[model samples]
Target: MGFFSHTEKLPGNWPSRFHHKCTSKKCTYPNSPQAAEGRYVCLGKVNGSPCKGTYEVSPSDAKAAAGWISREVEREAEQSKKLMAHLQEARRRKDDEHLQLYQNELATYKRVLQADAEGDIRFIRQYIRDIDSVALFEPERWHTHLIHLREEVLRLQRLVRELQLKTMNT
Candidate 1:
């Protein structure tokens, strides 16, 4: 009520006790000739003390108080709504940023794992080729060389499959 900026106006309708008076109390006027002749004093007490405020019963004063109070209430409500909307948007933006960062980290980890697996496969193929070349010159060791090569190839294939599955799961 104190924050409201009052303005002058003409007479208007008598809307009941929605506006605050001094100490939350309202004004009163007696049914007498003096009431029609003079201004009405607000009976509301301020800070536990009597209020000295007075206003005429004319339409101008009533309309002015009502209009000022209405505008202040509307302005405050709009400001509150805007503040809540801003907070919600900020939270949504932060959540999106965190999600993007997590996705980037996951992608980087998968790429490193894929590179390691490819390197392992490359080394296994080269080792198998080296053994085959030696076996061609030593015919007595051909069977043993093939068995060892097959075991190593099987192990490397299983390792590659496991790496693929790991990346897929995460």
Candidate 2:
């Protein structure tokens, strides 16, 4: 599998910056001051143990970043799902030809997303093209939307966690 490298975005004094040794679980790293020069110790292993990694942030900072990315991904997934639902409904209404064309376009867009080293936000909007082509029509059920949204949100959260870990080590 291909790996996603985040070296460019990560800071140098990682592990220690976000997580410190759990000397007292009750008193978390809240009282700890911000890192300087990317120097943070790794609390995951031994106390005051220096680690090497990049993309480090304070615990709170990491939380904020994760939340931001999660929200964005969730929104994207929900939009994609809405488009898919529209295509489905259109097909049911004897618009199979148009809907099939959208499916093809969606597949191509997914490929573009995978291949691009840096994602083009402009093309992201084209997902709307897929829906518009089919004259998008779908029952906007809150539960279904939430279900799809959760998938992308969790995936983005994982990515945030991985980036945090990376910062801690470098």
- The best candidate by lDDT is 1
lDDT for model 2 comes to 0.43
RMSD of 1: 17.1
lDDT of 2 by residue, 34-131 (tens): 33323344333225543232223445555654565567679999999999998866645544444445455445544544433365545533543444
Off by over 4 Å in 1: 1-59, 116-170
Q: How many backbone clashes does every candidate have?
A: 1, 14
Q: Which stretches of candidate 2 lie over 4 Å from their true place?
A: 1-53, 95-170
List model 1 lDDT by residue over 104-145, tens digit each.
Answer: 544544543444457655544454456456644565675475
